[model samples]
Target: MRVVSLVPSLTEAVAVTLPGVLVGATEWCTHPAGLDVARIGGTKNPDVPAIVALRPDLVLANEEENRAPDLAALRAAGIEVLVTEVRELPQAIRELDRALRACGASARPRWLDEAETAWLRLPPLQGRLRAVVPIWRRPWMVLGRATFAGDLLARLGVDNVYADHAERYPRVPLDELRGTRPDLVVLPDEPYRFTPDDGPEAFEAPAVLVSGRHLTWYGPSLGEAAGVLATALGR
Candidate 1:
């Protein structure tokens, strides 16, 4: 099946599991390094006309990474769009299977099955660690409520201090984050690159710099994400 993926995670999964299926992808779909395909545009503002011109049989997207209007535009052009929602690991695993099947993967990929096993094999947390996860630093936005990243951390025994906030990704005052007195400050290298020098200095707690792809992406990386993230959170 000819597919155009707007989500990076799905792009990597499709590219790895069913090669030669992707005809187009968003510029932000950067995993499986050296991936070569027609770049539609960014996730939030994809080039609708360019995508329609590709005439892909299926267009894959994430409800959060893509804009509703753009998906609507693609559907209006008679293109089929399958939007996936992944709020947590279980949902992400299910959605990945559903998406790949829609792309004509006759059987589930080994990597997908391994990813599920990897997460399931993770040892339960002896004690949870409280943390403040900052996604963006300009206005200081953090992971709040039912976020995939936050859920991943929780599975690894790190609890988000702001998980009860009204907004999923809320912009809060920097001072307020510091005031939370979390056990650790978890930082990822995307949406905002939080370095040891930049992010950790703002808070008194120790900092854990992690791979955003492993922490956030829900595809092939999921197999190794638990180990990588758990190790980082341990340090």
Candidate 2:
């Protein structure tokens, strides 16, 4: 099947499971390094004309990552579109499985096995730390409930102090973080790079800079991420 993937996580998954089937993808839907697929703009604004020209048998999208109008237009064009939304890790695995199945793929990598093995090897947290995971800077956003990053943190046994908040990725005030008094502050490397001088001195605890993809990207990459998180959290 010729597929156009609009979601970054699903793009990574398809590139891993059904590589040749993916005919086009969004520019930012990068993973499985050096993917030479056609660029369809970002997650929200896809190149509708280019996508239509591809004449794909399927277009993969995500409810959270795509804009409604673009999807609506595709559907109105009588195109077959599959939309996947992942709130947690398990759902991500399920969606990836579904996407692979749609492509009639039966083979999967050994990463799932590695992930299971890593999960079993994690040690119990001596003292779980409260952490704020910042996905973006400037306006200052933090990961909250129902986000992939939050789920990853939960699996590592670290308490997400912002999980109680209703907003998924909310702009947080620096003062609010001070009031929370997190034991650890996790600054994600992408979207924005927080430096040691960026409010670290004001923090009450030690901070760690981490790869956002390892903490947020949910797909075949999770196996590698599991190992990284295990090492980071001493899980």
Candidate 3:
């Protein structure tokens, strides 16, 4: 079955589970290193004509990672688009299983089981460390209510300071971030590439550099995300 995955995590899951099944993917899909596939474009602005030309049997996307218009266009072109919604960890696991099964997997992937088990094994939270997780700079937006990253961090015993915000991703003044005085600032390496030299200076709290793929991705990365993030959080 020819498939095109628009989400990086989805790309990794499908490629690792059913090698040679993906005919196209976004240029941003950088996991399962040495992946060689047709680059459609980025998640937000994928080239529709280029994707349609590949003629994939199924196009995999996420409700938040992919745009509605792009999915609509693919549907209008008569392509089957399976858009998954993953606001939290449970939803992510269920969607991953459903998406893979729809892609023709006879049973659940072992990595899926491993990923779930890893999280289940986490020791109870000793201290709920409050943190500010910035995803972007300049305008400065952060993880807010009902985000997968926030939920994942909660599992790791970290709470997002802005988790109660009305917006999923809220733009806050840099000064406000510092003024809120969170326990620490968690920085990820993607969506903005927050590095030690780049993101830490803006805040007064201690900074913890984390892998964006591990913090945000929900595929095979899930199996290791807990351990990786736990080490980063020093919990």
Candidate 4:
């Protein structure tokens, strides 16, 4: 079965679930090495021509990741597309299950079971860490209320502090941070790679550089990340 995965996390998970099945993926879909597959470009701007050339049996995408124009184009070409949108951990597992079933691939229901077991083992979040999650660098975009990242943070027992704001992602002015006086400021990697030393001197606090995908991605891999982050948080 020829399959093209547009989302990076699915690119990795699909490869694991159905090894030697993926035919194409976006440039960012690099994991489970030696893929060396065809690149169909990024999420927002897809290489339509290259993807068309692949002539895939199934095109796997994510609603929040891929742009509508690309999806419309693929559908216009009569391609069978499966779009997954995951807001929470369970939804992600369900989406993966659905994708596996659609592809006629070998996907066991036990993946969800194992994932749940892993999640149940993590310690509940205890302290309210005043944290800031930066999604971008220039102008500095942060995860606000109603975003997946904010929900994930809440699940992990850490409060967003910005949860009261209505925007999903809001850019805060540097001067506004002065009053917040965060206890732990988290800089997520990708979208931007932030280092502990890069923690601005204007604020006196302990900051941590974390993996964005690990903290925010709601996918089959979330259970793995929960354990990792829980350990990191020493919970």
CA-lDDT, candidates in order: 0.93, 0.78, 0.94, 0.75
Candidate 3 residue lDDT tens string, 35-145 = 989999999999999999999999999999899999999999999999999989999999999999988899999999999999999977777889999999999999999
Candidate 1, 94-184: lDDT as tens digits:
9999999999999889999999999899986778899999999888999999999999998898999999999999999999999999998
Candidate 1 — what's its lDDT?
Answer: 0.93
Error of 3 at 146 (Å): 0.6
For model 4, give the 10-residue run with minimal summed lDDT: 196-205
Query: For residues 1-235, could you state the per-residue lDDT of candidate 2 as single tens digits?
Result: 8899897777887887766888889888768799888887888889898899888889998888888899999888878899887888777777777777776678555665565456556666676778987776667788888887887788787888999898888889878877888888887766676667764565677787777678877677777887787676555
By summed lDDT, which 10 consecutive residues of candidate 2 come out lowest?
A: 107-116
The pairs that clash in candidate 4 are none
Each prediction's TM-score versus the true structure: 0.98, 0.91, 0.98, 0.90
Q: What's the CA error at residue 115 for candidate 1, in Å? A: 0.6
Compared with the true structure, model 4 gives a TM-score of 0.90
37 Cα displacement, candidate 4 (Å):
1.2
**Total clashes for model 2:** 2
Q: Report the number of clashing residue pairs per model.
A: 0, 2, 0, 0
Ranking by lDDT: 3, 1, 2, 4
Best-performing candidate as measured by lDDT: 3
